[model samples]
Target chain A: MDNLKIEGTKQTPEIDFNSSTGILSISGRSIPENTFEFFNPVLLWLDEFSSIAPEKVIAKINLEYFNTSSSKYILEILKRLRIILKDGKDILVEWYYEEDDEEMMETGEDYEDVSGLPFEIISIDDE
Target chain B: MAKQSIYQSEIENLEESKNFLKKSDYSKLELQMEFKKLVENYEELIDQVKIITKISDRLQKKLNKTNIALEDSNIKLADLNDQLNETIDQLTEAKIGRKAATIVMIVAIALFIVSEAFIEPIIDNMFPNNFLVGLGLKLVVAILIKPGEDFTNKYMLKKARKEQLRESQLSHNNKP
Candidate 1:
């Protein structure tokens, strides 16, 4: 149950998953050259985390942009969280977008509809 | 172990199913099982297609928004650059004008001193009684002052432009 921490890059997002606190946060752009390679480890980690997950898990996602392939992997992540919810775990997704980014806000709404996870779509000022 | 790509796995599965159908030696029960597996794969593929299409379209919208923002930033940068160049041009002209004025004034002073030291004696020897001749010489120097200033101004302006161009080219080359 070690924490998962990845530094953000120009083309990839940062990943900070704290098992102890049950606060999983991902932020920044995600346009990796190998989407599968980049996300496969994340999936593996989630698979392990499912059994040992805390009483409450909060996933904070603040993505500026992501490619189509990354979108699939995002769904896969949500699917894992859905499995946790099925196990009677309390979980929620906090989807953050910039104030002016209508597209991002709508995309968050779409994920909320499809993933069946309680989502809070929050808008923040541009940095 | 390296996992197979999604498309590769799908293609391999489809090929295997096709081969299974082509083989005529399969029993009825075996054929039904194989068909069932194929149907299952087909359904999963349809589900993947549904999600991928929706996500792809939404991501495309996000990309379009980013592209528009980038274009707007570029336009603003270009406008600011134009304003900066205009200011540089005005400053260069002002500097050149001052330098030209200084050179003309220095030349006029030198000419005045030389006239008193050499040209006045020469005038005395040639036309000592002719005040008009001395007046004409002074008038000639006064007339040349304007053209001298004009030449100096043009030369300085050209040099300033060349230096500015070289500096801009160097900056362009240095940019990543």
Candidate 2:
């Protein structure tokens, strides 16, 4: 299947899901006008990718800001990743946040606990 | 039309379970299995609600902080803009004052020249013995210099302010 690449905008995050390297990345702000419309395809893509996933799959998430609805979608994404893990694939979620963004770090921890998935809460330098 | 929710499927599942429970089922195993499914769904739903609420609250706090910072920055910017406008006004006033002085000085010089070449001769012809009239004309010209400069300065300042208003309006109109 062709790789999924959605460009980032002022209101939405970028999504780059590579089937070859199995390095799925989501970055930038996500406050789309319609959260379901924006994330439905992402969830569908994850469902399709779960079957043909590589032995090792890494999901890199670096979001600057997201609204309440986007938070639910983020959970859904993690749940999908958990399924891939259940399929005997080595899955890792690298959640990146700014050094000073304590809220984002705590949010990542919450996801980690809720999803019961291996997560690396990485702190990155602020631009 | 109503907007679609992310929890539509979960809600549909719950509705189905409710409909199934309303029926008097024959098999105990089937009811037990359905109860188990209901419990699982409820647990998952609770977990989702818990996590989502926590995250939403944290993010809202972050957003509040950002908004406070932005407001502070805007206040600072407004102060800076006021200072800049005051400086520009002072500069424009000084510039117009200088131009007005120059114009008044030139008019004074031209009046002096005219008095010396034409007005002085005419006065002399009219009153050959009176030197006071010529001196009085020069005095009047000197007296008018201050008022002339004041008038010029006021006119230039008014024009400058009108131009500034026009430019500001043009910029405001041009903004997308």
For each candidate, what's the DockQ?
0.39, 0.58
**lDDT of candidate 1 over B17-106, digit per residue (tens):** 999978879888998999899998898677767877887787797788778999999999999999999998999899899999999999
Candidate of highest TM-score: 2
Worst 10 residues of 2 chain A by lDDT: A40-49
Q: What is the lDDT of residue A79 in candidate 1?
A: 83
Q: Which residue ranges in model 1 land beyond 4 Å of their true spot?
A: B1-44
Fraction of the native A-B contacts that model 1 recovers: 0.38
Clashes of each: 0, 0
Worst 10 residues of 1 chain B by lDDT: B1-10
Share of native interface contacts present in candidate 2:
0.70
Q: What is the TM-score of chain B alone in each candidate?
A: 0.80, 0.90
Per-residue lDDT, model 1, residue B157, is 97
